[model samples]
Target: MTLPLSDSALIGTCLAATALGLIVMTSGGGGAAPTPDTAAQTETAASETAAAPEPSLPFGAVPAAPDAVDPEFGAQVRAYLLQNPEVIFEAVAEFERRTAQSQGDMDAALVQANADALFNDPRSWVGGNPDGDVTLVEFLDYKCGFCKRALPEVKALMEQDPNIRVIIKELPILGPESELAARFAISVLELAGPDAYDSVHVELMEYEGAITPDYLEDVASDLDLALADIVDLMESDAVSTVIEDNRALAQRLQISGTPTFVMGEQMIRGFVPVDNMLQAAAIARQ
Candidate 1:
C-alpha cells in the first residue's frame, strides 16, 4: 500500500534514496497506455525473473548501503553558520596570520642565504660605522617619494646609534630619471670613490628639482669632481653591472618598492618612522 509522506519524511526519503544509488521518479498522472507487444515483453521479463536463481550472499545476508545524513543535524548546522557569520571572519584572520608568518620565515631564509651580497658588496656604498655590530640594508630608488621621506629617518637612526651599519642598494625602478640618478651615483663611486658618491647621494635625495643630466653635472661641479668623467662612466658596463646585481638581489628578496630595509633577519617594507627603525635595530642586535 502507498502512504502519504510529510515534508520531513519526504526529505529523509530523498536523502536515503540518493545514498542508496536509487532514482525516485514522480508522475502527475498515468503515463501512456502500454502497447500489446510491450505488455507481452513485460510479462516475459517478469516470468524470466521468477525462473532465475538468487545469487549467494556473504554471511547469508545482503550488504547494507551507506547511511544518509541526518536532516535535523544538517538543518541545525546551516542555522548555526548563518547566525554566527563572524566564525568565517575568525577563520580568515587565522589564515592570514599563518600566511604572513610563513612569508616572514621564507624572507629570513633568503636574507641568510644572500648575506654576503647584501652586506659586503664592495661596489655598494657602506655608510655609518664600518665595524658596527648590526647591519641595516636599504633598497632605495631616488625618484621614490617615500625613499626621500625615509632619508632623514635613516640618518637619524645612524646618528643616534653609532653601532648600526647602513648599506644602500641603488634600485632605480621608477623610470628614466631614477635610472639617470642611480647611474650617476654609482659612476661617481666607481671613478671618484665613496666620498664623492656620498656627496652626490645626499644632494640627489634632498634636491627638489627634476633629475636631468645638467642637474647631475651641477652636483658634480659643486662637489669639485670631474663632471665629464662621471657622466662618461655612467653608461659603462661596470656601472651597469652594479645596478643589474642590485636588481637581481631585489628580485630574490621579493622587494618591489623603495625604502625597503633589511635589519638582520627582519625585513621592513616601505617607509617607517625613526622610532620603528630604532626598535628594529634593537631587535636585530638580539
Candidate 2:
C-alpha cells in the first residue's frame, strides 16, 4: 500500500511517469501501441491510393518539369520539319486540288442552269458540225491576244474533228475597238450568213491595227459585204440585243476573261493547249 504525498510532490511524480512512458513507447517497449483511430487512417490512405485515376503520361516516362517544356523536344521537331520541307508543298497541292474541284462543281452547275443561253443561242456564231454529238463553246474577245492565238488552233480542231460543233460568244470587254469588231462580226452573220461571219472572224482576228469604221469597211469589202448595209444593221436593236444577251450570259457563267472554253460539264477558264482542248472534246463525246 502507498501513502498519498503533498500536492507539489504528487505533481512531480506524475510528470516523471509521463516522460518515462514516452521513452518506452518510442523504443517499442511500452504497451501503448497504435490506437484504433490511427490504424483506420492508415488503411484508408492505402485504399485511396488504389482507387485514384491513372496518370495520362505514358508508362516509364517521367512527368514533365513544371517550369518549362523540354528544349530538345522542340529542337528535334524543328529539325525534322526542315528535313521534310516538301510537306508544305504537298499541303498546298492538296489545297489547290480541293479548290479546283469546288470551282469545277460550281461552274458545272451554272452551265447546266444556263444551258439554253450558253449552247443554243442563235445569235452566237456556230461553226463546225451543226448537228455534232459534242459541242465546244468559246467565250472570246476580239482584241484579246489569246483569242488571236486561238484562231489557228480552233480552225485546226474543226478541220480535224468535223463532228465537234464550236459556238463562239463575242465578249467585247477589252475596249471600244473590241466592241466594234464584235458588232461588225454580228452584223456580217446577220446580213450575210455563218460562212461570211466565219470568214470575217478570221480576217478580224488577223488584223493588227486599231479597228475603226474605215478598217471595218475594208473587212466588209474583202468579204464582199455591203459596208453601208452592215453599218445600218450594226445600229439595229437586234444586233445590240445579241451582244447584251451575251454579256448577261457571261455574267451568269462567271466568264471573267477571254478564250474560255466549255465542253459538256468541263470549263477551261484560260488558254489550255490544243491537246487539252481535243481531250476535253473527246471526254464530252463520251
Candidate 3:
C-alpha cells in the first residue's frame, strides 16, 4: 500500500477533518439551542441563540455578523454559520499565528525525546511484547485483503527472529465486519493464550474477504478450537477492553491504516520493504 500522509498529508487531513467537524457542529455541538431570529427566519420573526462553541468548525469560531457586512448579508452569514461557521478572514489569520507558535515549540519537544521511555513499554501500543528488543507493532484490519496478503511476512518475522517481538494491533476500519472480527480475535487471544493468538492471527490475516462470525467459526474449527469458547470470550469485558485499548493507541500514534509497523524508535506505517525493515532492525541493535 502507499505511505500515509505525513506533515503535508496531516495538513490536508486536518483540514478535511475540520470540515467534517464543522458539519457535525452545525448539526449540533450540544450547546444552548438557537431561537428563531430575523436572520434565520424572516425579519418578521427574530430569535436569539446563546454563543455556540464553533471550535470544531473550519478555521474555528463562528462566522461574520450581519451588521458587519450588509445588515441583511451579515445576518444571513451569521444565521447559517451559527449553524455552519467558517473562519474565513479573522480565523485564518489567527490560525496561522498560533500554528507558527506551535511549530516553534517542536524543537524543545524533540530535545526531550525519550526514545526508550516512550517505546520500550508494550502497553504504549496496547498489549504488546514489552520484553522484545525489536518490537514490531502491526496495525491490521481483519477484513482487509492486503492484511491477509501481509500475514506471511509478519509470521516469518516472528518465527525467524526470536528477538523481534511482534504486536498485532487490530485496526478494524473497513466496517462492522471489521469490528466483529476484531472482537472475536481478542476473545481467541484471551482463551487460547499466545499460541491461539498466533493461530487466529495468521488464519484471519491469511483468509480473504469480508470476515464474519461464520468465517471465525470455520477458522476456529480448522484450528480444533470450539466456536462457542471463542464466542463466549468475545463477550468478556476484558476482551472488549483490549480492543478498545488498541483503538486508543492507534489514535495516539496517528495511525491511518493497516499494516503500520513500529520497530525500535522508528515507526514505519504501511507495508514496509523487507530490506528497509531489516535496516531498521539493524539500527535498533546498534
Best by lDDT: 1
TM-score of 1: 0.71
Model 1: pairs clashing at backbone N, Cα or C within 3 Å: none
Between candidates 2 and 3, name the one with more favorable lDDT.
Answer: 2
Better of 1 and 2 by lDDT: 1
Q: Could you list the CA RMSD of all candidates, in the order they appear?
A: 14.8, 27.6, 14.4
Task: Write the candidate numbers in order of decreasing TM-score.
Answer: 2, 1, 3
Best by TM-score: 2
* Model 3 lDDT, residue 54, Cα: 40
Report the lDDT tens digits of candidate 2 across residue range 78-176: 455457655545655676678779998998899899999888888888889999888899999889988899888888888888888999999899999
Question: How displaced is residue 210 in candidate 1, in Å?
Answer: 1.7
Question: Which ranges of candidate 3 are over 4 A from the true structure?
Answer: 1-132
Off by over 4 Å in 2: 1-79
Candidate 2 worst ten-residue window by lDDT: 24-33
Model 1 misplacement above 4 A = 1-89
Query: Which candidate, 1 or 2, has the higher TM-score?
Result: 2
lDDT of 3 at 60: 61
Evaluated against the true structure, the overall lDDT of model 3 is: 0.63
